[model samples]
Target: MSRRALRGVLGIALLLILWEGVARGFALPSYTLPSVSEILLSVWRQRQLLASAAWFTMAEALAGYAIGCVAGIGIAVLLSLLPPVRRGMMPAMMAINSVPVAAWSPLLLLWLGVGIASKIAAVALAVGFTVFLSALAGLDRVDRRTIGLMRSFGAGPLSILWRLRLPTALPLIASGMRVSTVRSLIVAIVTEMLGAYGGLGWIIYQAVVQIDFVSVWSAILVASALSLAFFGLIGAIERRVVFWR
Candidate 1:
């Protein structure tokens, strides 16, 4: 492994060792703080159930992520093309975005019901603003001189956006997308915890009620893994798409 990877592994190992030592030394109860080994054992024993819940949660996260990305990019492009509309709409969008996703979750659950729709909507809302701001900033980053040159050469707004603005904005857009992957999963899970038929969050809630801390840790471990995978996937795609960077 590379030096960075080796250091990361070592850091994690040290943390796990410390965690295990504390749990054992204090003789902590399973309901309070289960050892790392106990959590790992529970994870293995309950892998099937955890896997099912993970799939359900991932489905909600992925659907919302897709919708958010498309909507964010499309809106940014449209607003860039229409300065008047952008001026009028930006404040409203900012006001709405200012509200936390958790605050919106209850309203969404009430409107969309406790089903997958609420979770998806919550995730979408959280991701949409993040991407929208990044994309808008990126689109606006084009040099005024470059835009003037393009216009002088008979390049219309659409053509300039396609050939100049979009390319210039790609790095920022990709960064937003990469960041959104984790947010998407987090929003989905948090919304699921409020009310969901099935998900990692739901499992965690159940475990907590039953005083099953090991199960809670296991579910968290799974969620962490899922988030890492999602983030890594986005990062990989960003590296490929933003090859010039």
Candidate 2:
């Protein structure tokens, strides 16, 4: 492994050691703070349950992310073509995004019900505005000189957008995608807490209600692992797509 990778592994190990020491030294209640070893053992005991929950939550996150990014791209394209719409829509989008994703959970649950749909919608909302801003900025930030030159050369609006603007915007769009991936997981889980058929968040809720702190910690660790894995996937894609940047 690389030096950076080794450093990261060491850092994580140190943090885990500190966590174990603190939990033991403080004699913390299992409900309040379970040790890493205990959490691992719980995970082992509940592997099947945790695995299913993780898969379900992952599906919701991924679905929502796809919906959000596609919708964001469409909105960005529309706004690029229509200045009036951009002016009118930006504030509303900003307002919605400013409100916490958790705040939307109840409303989404009310509308979408206590199922995977609600979780997916929440994730979409959480991920959308970020991607919208990035895509819009990417579409808007093209060089005026280049655009004018393209027009002088007889390039039409569609041609300019497809051939020049989109290429310029890809890096920013990819960056937003990478950023929103974590949000997607978070929003899905938060929404699941309010109501869900089954998910990591739902698992966490059940564990908490039963005061099964080990299960709670184990579920949380599973969620973290999922997010980290998804984040790494996006990072890899971004590196490929935005290599020039």
Candidate 3:
């Protein structure tokens, strides 16, 4: 591995060692704090639960991310093509983005019920503004000369969008997806914690309420792992797309 990668791994190892030593060496009670070993053991014992919950959470996060991406790209294209739409709606979009996900989760649950829909909606909302802005910026990055040349060639709006803007904007879109994937996962799990009965977040809530610190720590670690894996997948795809750039 590269030196930077090796250093990162070593840094993480050092942090984990510190955590283990502090918690275990202090002989902290299970309810107050559990050692890394204890958390790992608890996670092993609850493998089935983690697997099932992970599937649900992954589905919610990915589904919501897809929806948000579609909506953001569509809106970006429209806004780029029409000045009025861009002027009238961008501010409102920004305003919506400013609202905290915590405040939105309960309302979504109330409107959509305590089901997958609510979780998905929350995740989508968390990612939508970010993706939208990325896409808008991408569109703005299109070369004016290229656009004029396309226009001079008698290219229609759709043709220009498909042949020029989309390709040019791909890097930005991919960057947004990388960010949104992680944010969507966080929102999905948090919304699930608030309303849904199944997911890593729900498991964490249950652990906390039951005073199962080992389980709580295990759930947190699993959630972090899942988020990292999801982001890595996006990063991989991004590298493939932007390789020539």
Candidate 4:
């Protein structure tokens, strides 16, 4: 493994050690605060359930993320081509985004059903604005001077957009996708906890209600690991996409 990967592993190990020591030293009740080993054992014992729930959550998150990215990019491109439309709609977009997803979860569940639809809608809504705004900003960074030069050279609008704007916006879009990827998982899980079938969030909620402290902690750990893995994957993709930068 690379030094960076080793460092990360070591840091996580240290944190786990600290957690184990604190829980044991404090003589915290296993029901209230189990040691790291207890949580790990719980995770091991419940691996099948955790894996199934994780698969469900991952599917929802990825599906929502894909939908949000496609919609955000398409809309942002249209807005970039029409400055007047962008100006007129920017504030409304901001307002829409300001509405908390948590507040909308119940309504989404009511409107979209308590299944995958509600979870997808919640996750998409949670991530769409960030992706749209970031992509717009990236598209806006296409230099006016470059466009003017292209015009002077008799380059068409389509040519300029394809060659300049698209490339220029790639990094920004990548960054937005990274944010959306993480947001999708968070919103999807939260939505599941609010109203859905099975997911890591639902598992966590169930464990909490059952007062299974170690299981709850294990679910949380799985969630964290999944999020970090997705984020790292996005980062890797970004490096490949923006290698020139």
- Displacement of residue 216 (Cα, Å) in model 4 is 1.3
**What are the lDDT figures for the candidates, one per model?**
0.95, 0.90, 0.88, 0.88
RMSD of each: 1.2, 1.3, 1.8, 1.4
By TM-score, the candidates rank as 1, 2, 4, 3
**Ten-residue region with minimum lDDT total, candidate 1:** 1-10
Which one is best on TM-score? 1
Candidate 1 regions with alpha-carbon error over 4 angstroms: none
Per-candidate clashes come to 0, 0, 0, 0
- lDDT for 32 in candidate 3 is 81
Name the weakest run of 10 consecutive residues (lDDT summed) in model 3.
122-131
lDDT of 1 by residue, 155-228 (tens): 99999999999999999999999999999999998998899999999999999899888899999999998998
Badly placed stretches (over 4 Å) of model 2 are none
User: In terms of TM-score, how similar is model 3 to the real structure?
Assistant: 0.92
User: Tens-digit lDDT track for model 4 on 183-230?
Assistant: 888898889898778999899889879988788889888888899999
Candidate 3 segments exceeding 4 Å error: 1-7
What TM-score would you give candidate 1 relative to the actual structure? Answer: 0.96
